[model samples]
Target: MSTPHPHHFRPATTHADWTKTDQYHNKYLLSQDEALEFALKNTDANGIPLISVSAAQGKYLYLLAKTLGAKQILEVGTLGAYSTIWMAKALPEGGEIISLEVNPKHAKISTENIAHAGLSSKARVILGPALDSFPTLSPSPPFDLVFIDADKDNNGPYFAAARKLVRTGGVIVVDNVVRNGRVADDSLQTTDVVGVRKLLQMVKDDKGVEATTMSTVGDKGYDGFMYILVNEGI
Candidate 1:
């Protein structure tokens, strides 16, 4: 787990957001109890599961998908299958989450988790780098939502790919946008921070895309993620 923020800056130990808790801020949505339990159980035993997107982050993305009436979604990372379940559980009937995982072993575990959640049909685990598998989906379905939570170095390229996959009204969310609050400070030299900075710049400068970034403090740290809401005439 790569924690960019220290303890002093962490999100309040108390997660006030119902969306982040094991409970849901909204009804008609599956309680995250089962999914979160699965993540905690697997994360501690599996090591690096330490670096996963918080359950709050996953729930936030899931809520956005539901709001957008997303029928097709593409996720760049499927760590422990926690996020995969979050996204899949929120989909409308026939909605699907096509998640990408770099490691075959991780993908296998995610497959089991998805099945355990009874969402096997709603989610498809892709076993490879997103860059490799993403481009292969010729004439891809118009993804209504795209979530990027994998390697930080490829944010720009992934955003480019995400843009192509999503429809005009679709949304693209990249986790870890705050990068421990390092992005705002130009002196930082870490590759991940720099990469995120570039992506933010892209979002700000693009005229064709309209976006709004929400800044928040959470239990993890001063760091917060951003969501790029793409309104391609939608």
Candidate 2:
């Protein structure tokens, strides 16, 4: 008998499987918290796109910030402040997070959500294009962590701007980079894909930062994040 393709021996997993796994992990790994649930519910009630990170992903961001002892955070997107709330909660007593949102509606809703989470003291939502807001932050302390999750077309610009504001040894994370693995295919010239490709090339060419990408699958489906660490020499 001829040998079968290796695929024949492996079990196939579907979106349902990924979702179930995410739920399973959330059940055991996350604790009940009213503020976080309210953030999700309020965002949906306000008709904001439910594109914020999943519960597991939010917790992951929280843990990352907590582990880094991040005192200052700069967030490029503040959709409903879901992820913002998570990261803000990880800050120290005097730590602060400045989140930027281009949509006035989103900025308003996120501001409300942050206040509801009792994190208004730790987080602030700035309404405007991130590029416009970046200049205003020049006088502030360098951010220890930066999260970029806004328009894909501006990914390159956002990364470049963030690199300048982040402290040496700081971390910068870009979300939704893989786009279901389309990033590797040059034939796909979608703006989002093209943006990610360009950002990847920029990172590869930059000697001041060390970076890596991680593929993820959950209730939100397949996507990935890019993590870049600024070198001390820079």
Candidate 3:
């Protein structure tokens, strides 16, 4: 075996530092409360994949929901409900949030965490493939915001459904689209990256939505989210 590169030793540490500083800045300037802290602990205790959005990202979601005055929100992934709790806190009185999760264990823990946050009345965790659950979700009032954070391999389908479920003026946010910058390379055809590219193409082809993608570097390493705004008139 060849000798490992010296740069490999510092990357993880450097990434951790990046996340720490990002979190500190967000927390010092903004604030994340204890409920989010307990939800993170719940995720760890349940052995769920610690893949929930970072605190800063969670706060961003919360603020976005509040800014939108989102009455009905949909989350495509409910991993331990850390982000779920954050977004749910933005709901107005009588507002509701529906979170979809494929893993029953994850749904169970998400339900527990949401309840622990005193949001059970406003939030519900559905156990099923998001594709399957989407059909049953109502589009009556339509979702003011839809957050897609599930399996990246199905992002195209999720966005397609989100378009149908969101109001004309609503917003859709798909996370982890950048995947450490792999998304910029056309030769790499990983399913996750391919799905994101397909979704980008769909957005480009559809004139009803205005969309943009942004890259982020933090504790989650390098990744990004796509923000799509649905405009009136298809």
Q: TM-score for all predictions?
A: 0.82, 0.94, 0.91
Q: What 10-residue stretch in candidate 2 is worst by lDDT?
A: 134-143
The Cα local distance difference test for each model comes to: 0.76, 0.93, 0.89
For model 3 the local lDDT of residue 176 reads 96
Sequence-dependent TM-score of model 2: 0.94
lDDT of 2 by residue, 1-234 (tens): 999998778577778999999999899999998999999999999999999999999999999999888999999999999999999999999999999999999999999999999999999999999999887887256889999999998999999988888888889999999998898988999999999999999999999999999999999999999999998523
Model number with the top TM-score = 2
lDDT of 1: 0.76
Candidate 3, which segments miss by more than 4 Å at Cα? Answer: 1-13
As for lDDT, the candidate ahead, 1 or 3, is 3
Model 3, 1-234: lDDT tens digits are: 999898767534468688788877976766657888888888899898799898889889999999999999999999999889989999999999999999999999889888889999999998989999888987569999999999888999999888888888889999999998899998899999998999999999988999999998888888999999999523
Candidate number that wins on TM-score, 1 or 3: 3
TM-score of 1: 0.82
TM-score of 3: 0.91
lDDT of 1 by residue, 101-175 (tens): 999878877787788788988998989888999887642458888888888878988888778777887888887
